[model samples]
Each structure stands twice: as structure tokens, then as C-alpha cells.
Target chain A: MPHPPVHSPTILCTVDVVLLTLTADGLQVALLVRDRAPHAGALALPGGFVRPTEDSGTRDAAARMLREKTGLHSPYLEQLATFSGPDRDPRGWSVSVVYYALVPPMAPDDGAPAAVEWHPVDRLPPLPFDHAEIVRQALARVRSKSQYSSLPVHLCGERFTLPQLKLVYEAVLGERVNQVSFRRRMDELGMLEPMVGETVGGAHRPAQVWRVKEAFRGELSLSERVLAGRD
Target chain B: MPHPPVHSPTILCTVDVVLLTLTADGLQVALLVRDRAPHAGALALPGGFVRPTEDSGTRDAAARMLREKTGLHSPYLEQLATFSGPDRDPRGWSVSVVYYALVPPMAPDDGAPAAVEWHPVDRLPPLPFDHAEIVRQALARVRSKSQYSSLPVHLCGERFTLPQLKLVYEAVLGERVNQVSFRRRMDELGMLEPMVGETVGGAHRPAQVWRVKEAFRGELSLSERVLAGRD
Candidate 1:
């Protein structure tokens, strides 16, 4: 059989990032106003076209876009999925290698710039292209991973109490996790390191401040059992 | 801050599949010999460049390539990762969206074509390009996911007994899983449905034959607890 003529057209390639954080309101994602056509001035995920001259790979492109656009360095950024199609982009057929980032809560007084907007993930407004679906998948990945891994800890500060960490898990999972079961699972995961002599004020006792172990900062420590939730 | 000039060069995008199956020799991956220049005649993952006019998306491209190249319809095909870089491929800066497919054991008499070679995953030949690393990542993903999901069931046939399914899990995991624990975990995952009036030969008694539920054919049912392994 004769091979079909190779049709390798100029496929538009780009990378988009879903920056997520824990805020007082709840789980929120950072959005930026597009400066170029196709969706100029509309809110969208922070992204840009892949530059072969500069980026070594797609993850490098995602990290560079996150730093340049948000002015925030994420400790946990993962490739969520690659979205592609003919109708997704107006200029031509395109592919967007998407990533989701997690950061600790920003200082309340240090308000974000006008271009960067933090919107609740569940209540995002209409976004351009297939970004809405992208955010939905990112959120689902974060939530599902939070169940069996130490993923939500990225949303906590370098040092945090167990109660604070539990709150972060609840925020990410959107469900109340059983206290005892959470502690047991955390022990099994072995992801936390106690900050020696560090204690924080608590309602009943001085709580020990803990941080994620150095080894598990970039890679998540998975649990053998899922976190039990309060029904 | 000055805006950087956009340099969107043509990125060579393609899709490769790591078709894996269970044989007496262990886990093996399907590979094809390269036919064109730039490592022509070398064994490599079955792949091709994206066709914008034909493929609606990258996944569509992957399905199309699998059908045309392997002559096998994969029931479980999932995107593993997107490998990219300037140095990996000799042609130019490229991106390869990879997917891993699982199949059951084929009859010994029905030998694969000379073009299609099934190499033991652990002991692979020097594959062209970054095909080796792609296979490594695909294998790691399949093994890791097998711990808490019904992913290994895809390596079993349409009708399987509990004992037969356990062996498949052991093969994919490369570890001896406890019989009692394996059965309990499978029950908790709830992916299998009993084929009424069907029984298979067993060591002690006629064992009930089962098949994966229709709902889980495309998706895996995850177990909250990991499959226990004996020391």
C-alpha cells in the first residue's frame, strides 16, 4: 500500500498554566487578561507560544510563562494535559500543553496586580478557547490526586501546624477529612518533617509546626490508602 | 519591562504508542522498524507525524496510528506523556505525544509479522531517538497505576477467573501480590462482574468466571488501598 502523502502543516503550538492557591474565599486560580488577538483583553489562563530557541522542553516553557506573567514562582507545577484541535484556535490548528501550579497563600495586604486576577475555580467566568475545559481538568486532577497523595501541601506555607495542613486538604478536596484517619494516612505517607522546637499558638495546646520533607518537595509521597472523608 | 519578540518556529509534532501485552516471557512492547531516513531500519515505537487535515486531535491521531500500524484494536489506550526537546529527534525540534496500550496474550502459533517485533520491556534493543525513555516512562506509569487501579485487568481476556486475573496483576506489577489481599482489593475496586452460569477449571473447585463491567472497559476503577505484596 502506498503511504499517504505526509501532511505536516504548521501546527500552532503553545503552553498554558493553571496557577492555583488557597485563599480565604476557597480554591482559586490565577488568570491574566490576554493582550493579543483571538481573545484580546479577555480573562484566560497564563500562557504563550512555545519558543524552540529558548525553551528546552514544554515544562520549561510553562515555568517561564508562570514566572514572567504572574511574578510568582511555583514550587509545584505539573503538566495537566495537552489540548488540541482545528477549531480551538482561530489562527490555525493548535496544541496547548497545559500545566497546573500550586502556591502558598499570598499576603492579604500585598494585593495582586490589575492584570492578574484570582477567580474561584468552581465559579470561573467564561474563558476564551478551550481554557474553561482545561481548568476543569486541572481542578479534577488536583482534587483526585489530593485523595491519595501529598499534593495539597503545596498550598501551605513552608511551616504549618497539623490543623492548618488539615484545612488545606479540606480546601483542595472540598470535603471534610476525618481527623484521625488523616493523621494516620499522613504518617504512612511520611512526607512531613517536624520543625524542631517550633511551636505555634493553638486553641488547646501549642501545636508543632511541620514542613514537607526535603525529598518530597518536588515529588509527591503517595499513600497506600485513600484519605477517609466525613460523609 | 520590554516585551520579548515572539519566535514561533515549526515544531514537529507526532504521536507514538507503547503497545504492551502479557506473554510467557513477561511484559513486552510492540515496535516497528523505521523505514525512512534519520535512523532508517532501526527498531522504534510505532509512530507518525500528526496530520492536521485528518486528525481531529492528538488522541485521534494516536488511535488512527495504532489501527493502521499494528492491526490491533486496543481496548485500553491512555496518554502517557509528551516528550519534547531539540536534541532528542534528529529532524528538528519536536514533540511526541505518547500513549500506552494494553492487550491480552496472543496465540503462540499466530506469529507477529517480521516488521512488528515484541521485545521484552526490561531488555530492549538500542531504540532510535528517545524511544527507550518513552518506553521506560510508559512502563513506570503502567506499574504505578496498577498498584491502586484495575489497569492490569486489561491484560486479561474477555472472560477471566480470579486466579487468572491475579497472575496478570503479578505480571504487570513485577511483584508477587498476596492472594487474599488481591482478592479483597479487586472486590473493593468493583470492576468485575460475574458471568452467570460460567465456571472455569481451578485447582480445588470450579471457579466463577468474570468479565470487567461495561462501564469500566474504558475507565479504571481505583482501589482506595494499595495491593499488598508479600516479602
Candidate 2:
């Protein structure tokens, strides 16, 4: 066995959030310009060091970072994976516990004050410190979960017609969905409740508006059958 | 924001492995009696603090601990979740990057001399730290993955008959599986290859034995259709 160093280096701990939202163009990630050293002025994911004195745990730190950096509270937040190594960070050996957050499309007048830049995921510019890989993994996870879950609904606002929700699913899935099957699958999920006296005018007819059930706002409804890509 | 501590305590980093194997009784977890404080003499999962000098990353640390303590090399190991907090450990703030390893049942003389005790997961004794919660999460993850993937096959020897593999799946799932559907599901997975001239005698007939394809030893084959519990 090797003896420990008289003064071993402490590991640097931090949390990074991959905040994703769907737009007219496609899936986009929220990023901010780094305001500190090591990568100052470079665009990067919203992240910060883990403040043990203030954070109850890593999850709390993740939520706090999301709130502080992006100024947007995600309707869905989940721990994706932890990335660590000696060579990943220049300051020292580091471990980053990453979390992915899903929020509905934000209106221009939303109260968030952060200067967040939304970039298409597939056409992202070069990122620093393994953040590009982190975004890729988060995208893969969201897409995979969308195949058999109510995950994509998190990208839709509270009141949406079935066609509107279907578009959100198609945007995340990157494929067309059969209208009939999509309706049937949504019925099976039972995660949405039709809002009484709320209807949206469609090209052919008025469509009933729906909102995710209060019980499932923070949770997901899963299905055994996967949504197949376009035939 | 609060001011930083004059000398803030560093987070104690570690890795804990939940080593699981199926037995005649059902799923069992491997545990070791801690030989040092703060929980000396208490049984807990095989774990240790991360050694940045020798370990490339947290995953490397987990593999090292499993090798040094258990003496059994697992073919299937995956990151389960990270457990972290200030109050979870007695010394100070800590973060445990947890990994779960799946290995086939061992023989009496498997060359492992760690005095390892296998306890049924459902009937585990009191454990130290947040280990009880860690074990629960590991079990839940394994069971969830087993429902739609060839994950339970990790609990079988290299060469096993179909009936034998089915038994392993049943033990992990805690329910009886339909014979016809099980065979069909295995065919869909296509992860097995029949060994030439390898036959095991059974009560009714000679059963042909099969081994997992080399390509799938480190990965799993998944299906969209879930394995339903006992009807």
C-alpha cells in the first residue's frame, strides 16, 4: 500500500444544471457567460461550487444554482449523472454532480432577469470543462425518457391543446407522431385533466385545453410501449 | 449571500458499492464489518474514501474498493446515485458516489477471504450511516432495470440452461414468470448463444446450456415491453 501524501489536495465540488426548453426551432439549452476566472467571458452551463455551509445537500445546491443563475424555476428537475476526474478541471481534482431541468417555453416578459442565451443543442458552440458532453448526455436522457413517459409535457405550458402537446413531443422526439396513437397514449397516461369551459380554436375545430394533473406536475407517468419514430 | 467560513471544512468524498447476487432465498447484498471508527464493528456496505492520488475517478475508486475488499470481479457495475450531506456522517460533510455491482453466485472456494456475509435484502440488519437508504435505492434501481432488460442474467454463471436463467430472473423479480413469454423475451434480447455440446440434465429432459455473447458482457439488452409480475 502506498502512503498518503503529508498534505493531500482537497477535491473541488460543484453542481452544474443543464436547463432545457423547447422552442420553435427545436430543443435549446440555457447558458450564461462566465463572470469569474478560469473561463471568464466564456459561455457555459449555469453552475457554481457546492457551498457546504449553506447547502443542505448536493440536490439543494443544484436547485439553488438553478434559481440564482438562470432566475427560472424548472417544473421538472432530476439528477442526471456525476462527472469527475483529475484532468477535467484546472483548479484541482473536481466532482460535478449534474442535474437536468425542464421548463416550459418562456415568454419574453417572463420575470427572469438573467441574460440567458438559448442555443440549439445540436449546433452548440464549443463549451469549456466537459460541459458539451454534459449537455449531450442530458439531451439523450430527455429523449429516451420521452419515448415512454410524460416527460415532454414539462416543455408545455399549463393550458395546452392536444395538438399543441403533440408538437412539443415531436420537437423533443425529432419525429412525427401519429395523431390517433398520440391521443390514445395520452389517454393511457392519464396525466392531463381537461380544463372545463376552456377551448382553443383549431384550423378545423375547437380543441379542448388541458393541464397536467396536480398530482403529476412533479412526477412522471410511465408506459410500457415506446413511441416509435416516423415510419 | 452569507460570508464564507474562515476555514471551511472540505467535503469528505467516498465511494460505496452495493454488491448484489441472487441466491436460493432471493436477492442478497454483500456486507462487511467495519474495522475502524466511526462505526467500527458495525456491518455496512464495502466502501472507502476516495484516494485522488491512486484513483483516476470515483468509478475507479469504487472498482478498487470492490476488488480489495470482496476479491470478486463483477462483470456488471453501474453508478446508482450519489448520497451527500453534512449530517449523514459523524465526522463532517460528505458525498458518497454509490455504485451497484452484480455478480453471479459464488462457490464455496471462490478465493474470497473477506468473511463476507450475504444478507437477504428485504431482511437486512441495522446498518451505519445512510447505508440503509442506499441499499433501498440500489434494490429499486436493479428491480426497475430488470423489468425491461437482460439485467438479471448477471446473477447466473457463464454457462446456464434456460430454466436456470429463468430461475435467476424469477428470484430477482420476486415472482414467477410465464414460460412462453420468458422464452420469447430472451429471443428478443438475443444476448445468449448456445454452447456446442453443452448439455445439463434436468428432471424431464436434457437442457441445452447457453452463454451470454461477449458483446453484451459489459452492457445490457433492453426491451420496450416490461415483464409483468405474477398474474
- Model 1's DockQ score: 0.39
lDDT of 1 by residue, A1-231 (tens): 333334367788899999999998999999998998777999999999989999999999999898788877545989888888888978777888998999887774444455788999889999999999999999999998999899999999889999999999998888899999888888999999999999989668999999999998888998756785732
Tens-digit lDDT string for candidate 2 (A1-231): 332322324788888999999999899999999997667899999998888899999988988888887777655999998999988877767899999999988876786555789899999989999999999999999998998899999999888999999999999988889988898889989999999988979668889999999999999998767775532
Output candidate 2 Cα RMSD.
Answer: 4.3
lDDT of 1 at A86: 83
DockQ of model 2 vs. true complex: 0.34
lDDT of 2 by residue, B2-63 (tens): 32322324788889999998888889999999997778899999999888888899998899
**Which window of ten consecutive residues has the lowest lDDT sum in model 2 chain A?**
A1-10
- In Å, residue B39's CA in model 1 sits off its true spot by 1.1
For all candidates in order, the CA lDDT equals 0.86, 0.87
Q: In model 2, where do residues sit more than 4 Å from their true spots?
A: A1-9, A202-204, B1-9, B202-204, B229-231
For every model shown, the clashing-pair count is 0, 0
List candidate 1 stretches off by more than 4 Å: A1-7, A108-113, A202-204, B1-7, B108-114, B202-204
